[model samples]
Target chain A: MGEFEIFGMPVSLGTMIFQAVIFTALIWILKQKFLSKLVGAMESRRESIDNQLNLAETYKHEAEEELLKQREMTEKATQEAKQIIAKAREEANIIVKAARKEAFTIRTEAYENERRALKGRGAS
Target chain B: MHATRPLVQIFGLTFDLSIIITSTIAALVVLVFAYACTRHITAKKPGKMQNLLEWVIEFVQNIMVNSMGRKDNLFILAGGVGLILYLFIANIMGVPFSFIAGADHATWWKSPTADAHVTMTLAIMMIVYTHFIHIRLHGLKNYFLSFFKPFKALFAINILEQFCTTLTLGLRLFGNIYAGEVMLGILAAAAMKGFQSGIFIGIGSSMLAAIPMMIWQVFCLFIGAIQAYIFVTLFMVYIGQRVNEATT
Candidate 1:
């Protein structure tokens, strides 16, 4: 009546099961009320910190890349502008030289006509 | 003194309420301690109580991680903190207060963990949980087939191993806590005997008996903690074995 024998082992299954059920309730309450909440809060805090660190790192790398790209683009633009300006100045100089040569040719042709006219008059 | 004294009847079920009452008090003590220690926990500027709570939580977490390699889910779901706290508190329950109260004062309140019924229940639960995990993870076929692995000769040994889990775990905790409590009881009896004797001899003898009794109480602290740790360690080990691919 006190304790029963099961498989040659004396045990109070009722008490054992009762205790188990009691502890199960205890763990459930503790988990729901305290342990789970605390652990979750700690995990979230850690995850948030990790996320912020990652965001900061990504932003830093992106900013550095943007700065490098802009510097390269500025250099490229300056080189191209200088080359265009130099080429334009050279073309203007060539135009000025051609105009001077054309004027010289016209002037020489007029002088020849005048000389020829004077020669013809003197000869006549 | 009888440990299983009938306390009260609720409905039709008569019960031995010593373990229940002691366990409830132990549970409440742990609950209050936890609540007080962690109620004002802050992410920044944590107090000593918070630090202690964090340390205990992390310690249990580390045990799980180390034993189960951080992959298994049971390591997370089965909180070792409560088990350790409960067992440890129950193991030391006799240190602060324990008395024999009955019609003849033959019924006693010792450590709840000292009770075989309570320890067996905890052990059975752990083993059941481990077996459930093993079966779920490895599949029922594999779980059963695992007993006969490395040739079919290991079948009986494997069965015994399963039975032994609850037996050993429960008996070990019960034996240790019970022994310690019994020793304290002996010391208390000695002190009482000496204190109750004739005049001059009583005072001197009682003082002498009280000395060892106090010393043993101090020693019981270490024993309680070590027993709790061993219980937790064995539990995690069992879980680890079950979850792993190896049947043994």
Candidate 2:
């Protein structure tokens, strides 16, 4: 190792060994302090993003469900309104029919009494 | 014409102080960047530094996944990020300010990766780590058998490939960075010579030198970034070969 020279630069075995050690220490320090934290931060960011997406999905699903429920209620109210209108129409028809029958009976009774009085006056 | 470096001897070993100092500066710069980036990490709203740090991390992860088809190994992911950060910072550290001092013209500051020893050290470390992982993943017997592969005649060739990978990985980075610096130095020297010539020639020649210098500086920055990327990509590729081959 002593007489090794290339391009006027002496290649030192000592320096090589020493630098390897230095590089190892550097890797260890960087792994412990910098890399781990950065990875952790990245992971946490990913987790947060995922959580937010999930929450949004849940909200969307809930909104859809609520919309469905509102539509069903509106449909139910419409059906009820139709049923009420139908029932009122039926009641009105029944009342009109009964009033017409009563009016007819009263007219027949009046006509019968008038005939009976004419016949009795003729007999007298 | 080769530059001289200040040397110190301790315990029968020669240590280059310049390389040590420059490398330490590079390491310190990387550490400071890491610290500042991680000081107040936030998941919801990351600051610029944190964003930068995460970008590098994800970038490295993407490289690994693209190459290795796996990213469950957090240790390797972090290692990749660290390697890139160190190499990039070291490769570009000397670009703006390279200090050659004293009568010896000893380089007080320069890119540590410009030195073969530093790059070789990293390459060796990374290669050794890959082999370790290969062995750990496939046991010693399987790892040894890997050399013989589909054809037993290719044993020697496989063994040679390991050496080649290491050599190329280290040398590629060293060559690019060193050549850039050398060219920059030549331009600077020309500028200095031009400055000493005469009034008009000095200004004219120096201006001529400055254009290339500026252009080379930008080129060096581009090369530094590219070299760092290449080193890490190759590293992941090597590791991927080691790790993925076991399953198949």
Candidate 3:
């Protein structure tokens, strides 16, 4: 095998240079065409994910607000139920008191009439 | 043999015939598959090949986005495509030759990355590209000064780091693939010698030794692909770091 010399050195500088040029071109093409699109697509995807996350957060907030409203409605219903029950109890108490008073008056009037009739019978 | 030689000659340097043939064939096959998948792609549903191609593309895209932080770097796709094409062919290089399975010369079908010269060239390209990006982002003065620190010792350390990055990038890929080829060769030789020595090894016993080697080879193939990926990814990270620092 015969060695070829270049610049007083027995090195395949030409091959190395050729390879280097090819490599550079490949990288340049890659960077210019492929990477630019990839980065754009990636940025768009990230934005989409962020939008989705924001929407999810808004949904979560809405759900929490609905839950709080429901809780307040339940509390209001419970308080109203307690008030209605209390009012019904008060009305029942008043009705019982009036009936007892009317019953006592009727009994007293009947007793008075009976006593008067007995006195009349004894005199005659 | 003479007729089969000199398939690739540039500037009086000759590369083996089979390497160029096998690499070209593999590249063409991959390109055809990509084209076929793209042609048949649909919005409603994807075929098997389309789905597979999409998975690879999306995987590489995700890695690029995650590593580079969604910079407008279209080069990642080119890097990714080159990586996949190179790595798949490299892994399959030894599969065709049944008779010369374990011989050193059997590697006439060289995985381009398995060769130190090839890997070094790629690594140098990445280094130069990253530096170009750095200079574009920071200008020559800032880029050059970035290698130095206020403290002289730290400046020296920064220089060392740069050197190490290039060295590691080349050596890591070269070491992994070369070791894998060597391992496969050894295993094949052992199996062949065992068969020839009238050992009368049972099929089960033979499989016991062979199965692990086969599994390991598959694992090595995956590792090789990942190493290529890591190299490109690190290159992006280096560029990103420089860009972010300059902007800040």
RMSD of each: 11.2, 6.6, 8.0
Q: Which digits, one per residue and each the tens of the lDDT, describe model 3 over residues A68-89?
A: 9999999999999999999999
Q: Supply the DockQ value of model 2.
A: 0.42
TM-score of each: 0.74, 0.84, 0.61
lDDT of 1: 0.78
Error of 3 at A109 (Å): 63
Per-residue accuracy of model 3 over B1-248 as CA lDDT, tens digit each: 01112234555775444444454555556555656656554543457865676676676667667766763445556666555555566655653222232323344455555555456666777677778888887789987788765565688888888788887887788788767766666666666666776667544446665887878678776877677677767766776676676655
| Model 3 misplaced regions, further than 4 Å | A1-124, B1-22, B41-47, B95-106, B150-153, B195-209
| Candidate 1 lDDT over residue span B158-222, tens digit each | 89988987899999999988888888877767766765777776677778877888888988888
Worst lDDT 10-window in candidate 2 chain B: B1-10
- Model 2 compared with the native: what TM-score? 0.84
Model 1, B181: alpha-carbon shift in Å?
A: 0.6
Span of ten consecutive residues with least summed lDDT in model 3 chain B: B1-10
On lDDT, the candidate that comes out on top is 2
Task: Name the best candidate (by DockQ).
Answer: 2
By TM-score, the best candidate is: 2
Would you list the C-alpha lDDT of every candidate in the order shown? 0.78, 0.89, 0.63
Model 1, runs deviating above 4 Å: A6-10, A48-124, B1-14, B71-78, B246-248
Q: What's model 3's lDDT at B157?
A: 88
